[model samples]
Target: MRTFDTDALECLAAIVEEGGFERAAVRLSVTQSAVSQRLRALEAQVGTVLLVRSRPVKPTSAGRLLIKHAMQMRLLRADLETDLQDLTPGAGALREEDRISIAINADSIATWALPALGPLVSEGLPLEIITDDQDFTHEWLREGQVLGCVTTLKQALRGCKVMPLGAMHYVAVASPAYAAENCPKGLTTHNFRQIPFIAFNRKDDLQTEFVSRACGLRRVALIQRFVPSVEGQVRAVLSGWGASVLPTLQVQSRLDSGELVNLAPDVTLPVNLYWHCWNLDSVVIDRLTAALTTAATQALKVPG
Candidate 1:
């Protein structure tokens, strides 16, 4: 039997994680040709293709399986080191590069995600976070860019575990002045059709979805403003550019201060989020998951 070598698997994992041979080489501190040679050797040993070799190299099913094992090996190595250091009275503690990288939506990151991971970071464990739109974060998981993700999808990725994170409540809000001026009769789906909407970017559909659900309509007014960042989105709403669907956590202070008013108090947008990750037995990953689950339960309202 041809057993897979941990070093070769590590090289393949790095290549998939970095998305290219040159970048992977830089990360591994080796020449690009050396990285390529390692991958070729691994493929020959397994008698199967592992990477797609495209612009951003994608992993084949076989590659993903090995990458998952490689991540597990990293965690095992960390645990071994920690166990070895237990012999010393207090030998400075074990520091390892074993990380649980997560790709999560911007809204979740801006709201409850980081707080959920606070316990892990406080314990000195490494975590890597990649923020993108909720609709797109799954691609990172599929490509092996991250070991885990907080995604909007309910289904688990192949060879991965999925757990419900909870729903985030959003409300359409606008500056007091904007509401007073454009929203004479108070904010309603009927009047919302005419008012401009503020969005995070072209990918943002919060306003559109809200308007559609509220008015039994589809698209919102085309006269829209784009603010790419979470802070910028709030600022745009505050600057009277247009109304926006703001997360409760992000606008709680402003809402309490009377700076921003709810457009429709009865209408609420609840986005359900889920935690997805590789199914691996890793102490560090298990610890992080437990902490995240605890924090999320406290921070979010559990669905009935």
Candidate 2:
């Protein structure tokens, strides 16, 4: 097996992380040509192509392996620096941003996640947040893209610690006028099938799932509208495009104002969320976990 030098491996990892040779060069304070040469040398040493040379470059499987090692090395270096600092009297303690990266879903980020993260930000901790869909957030943890996440998955990934974040409450809602016109009686399993639905996107199935659970049916009205963002989804529902399942936090004001009516007051979907993070001993991760736990307790209702 050919031996890979530490510097070359680190360089390749930087290129992959930064997503381009030029950016990696800027990060490492080296010339673009120098970054290119190091990548070429590393690829030659490995006897395979490590990166796809395209706009916003992507890593090959071999490159991913090296990137993981590079991240581990970086963490180790950071720990060493912390140890050295500890030996000096009157040295300032390490800040949060210097220690962690987190991945979360957009709904959580927009609603409950930020409130939980306030303590960390107030303390000047360095945090990088990647917001995506709830269903797919765990993929970032699996790929080592983030050290922690708020995900819907219950199972813990290998080498990670998993804890329950809390359940998000959702209710089927429609504008008061629309509800009065279309729903003379309160919503039940039988009437839900006939109601036109507003979906966040083609990928969203919250309405469908609610209908399925409520009525034990699969077919919904073919006439559906798509609104992609959380705010847009709420607006579309409020505008009477169709009824949708919205988080209570997002639609609480409208509900209070009688602008939107709950389709079924008793019917709700509680999506249980989990926190997954690398199972490592780090003060930053611990602090984040504590903050999220406190926030979840206050914001999310316990599943019944």
Candidate 3:
């Protein structure tokens, strides 16, 4: 039987996670030279290069497999820790390497996901959250950078399980002042193109999709300003930067207070979200799934 060094494997993971050898050294409490040496030894043992040395270093395909293995081993350790704590209560604490990492969409994180995770965080679950657009979060899980993710993808990855968590309803909204000045007739076929729209990022298509659906057009385009955050987009809209498609749950207070107006009160865009996790018998995974699903059920609209 062939054996690989566990420390070396963890060094590779830390380097990739932290983005560089110096940062990885700081994370692992080792010297920078030591970090490099460990990585070299690991590559030699594996008989291939693992990482692409770039700014915010990226893993090669082989490195991804190794990273996934390392992360899975960490999950196993976390599971064992949970078992031990149940037996003795207030037992040994989890190390930094045992931190649970997951990817979630920025909108969900701003609205319901953080609150759902509060109990676990307060109880000492070392958690790392990677936020991205809902459509792209699945890539994090596919790359083995996260143990689980809340994403728009419905199909489960190989060796993964997926559960539908309903859908987030989005409404096109703008500041009352902006709406009155720019879109007095609300979002119509003629006015949508004239009114600027705030998009989360270049990757976001919700704004365009909403406009097309609302205007009964095959294709539509609007002037876009990127804000990159759910809360930031809301702030920009309130500042009269542009109109945006925002979560109804996130902007309900503003709407009620008349700070913002729904551009299409009768129309809403429903984005279906799902929870994906590895098909492993880990108590922590089960707990996370339960927490996310329960909160999503209450917070998100059931998709028709």
Candidate 4:
């Protein structure tokens, strides 16, 4: 049986999380030289190159395995802290490195994820959220960059648990004036190519997918404008920049107010989401899973 140094494991996590040796040192309250030494020592013990020396440090395959182990240990430690606090209130305080990090799609973060995590944060949970597209968020967890994630992937990764979180319904919408000017017939195939579509980012294919399905085409191309955030996309639509496929929950108020109109009332997209986390016996993970599932049940559309 082999035992590894906990300090070295945390140093590696800091380097990857903070993005560089200098930042990792700052995070760990150690000198850069010491940080490097710890990493080298750990590498010596593991007998391989653990990190790539890049602008933003990236972990090797072995390094990812180690980082996942470190995150699991941190979760167990947090659970232990909770137990100790119950026995003697205010006994242990977690350090900066002990923050619980997770990945969520940008749309969810803007809509319901933050509110679900708010109570825990208010009680000093030290939560960090990393946002990406729902289709790709699973990569964060697979790479061990985050302990948990809400993503569109249904299958559980090895050594992880998954739960369905319902689906987010999307509708094609635009400002009333824009719709009248660009899509008078309500987003027919003929007009879809003429009107610009507001995409969340280059990775976003929702607009293209929705338009293609609505038009009954194998594929269709549309003029596109990019807005990286959900709120930014909504604002761009409100400003009459372009048509967008937005969440019904996000645009319901604007639609009700007649500021935006659904371009395709009958065509809707429901993106199913799932919560994936390490299958660990930790109170923190349990609490997070509960909060997210409960909130999703109320906020997202039930899948039939």
Tens digits of per-residue lDDT, candidate 1, 9-96, equal 8789888777898888888788999998999999998889999989798888888878876766776775565555556544543333
By summed lDDT, the worst window of 10 consecutive residues in model 1 runs over 88-97
Model 2: per-residue lDDT, tens digit, 112-181?
8898888767654556788777888888778776778998899999999998877998888998888888
| The candidate that achieves the highest TM-score relative to the unseen native structure | 3
lDDT of 1: 0.78
Question: How many clashing residue pairs, candidate 2?
Answer: 3
lDDT of 2: 0.77
Worst 10 residues of 3 by lDDT: 1-10
> What total of clashing residue pairs does each candidate reach?
0, 3, 0, 0
Give the poorly placed runs of model 1, Cα more than 4 Å off: 81-97, 142-144, 155-159, 201-203, 218-226
Model 4: pairs clashing at backbone N, Cα or C within 3 Å: none
lDDT of 3 by residue, 1-304 (tens): 5566878889999999998999999999999999999999989988999999999999999999989888898898888988898899998878877779999999999999998999988877889999999999999899998999999999998889999999998999999999899988788877887888999999999999898888788898789999998999999999999899999999999999999999999999899999999999999999999999999999988867
Clashing pairs in 2: 96-126, 97-125, 97-126
Q: List candidate 3 segments past 4 Å from native.
A: none
Error of 2 at 59 (Å): 2.3
The sequence of per-residue lDDT tens digits that candidate 4 reaches over residues 38-68 is 9999999999999999889899999998998
TM-score ranking from best candidate downward: 3, 4, 1, 2
Better of 2 and 4 by TM-score: 4
lDDT of 2 at 71: 54
Tell me each candidate's TM-score: 0.82, 0.80, 0.98, 0.97
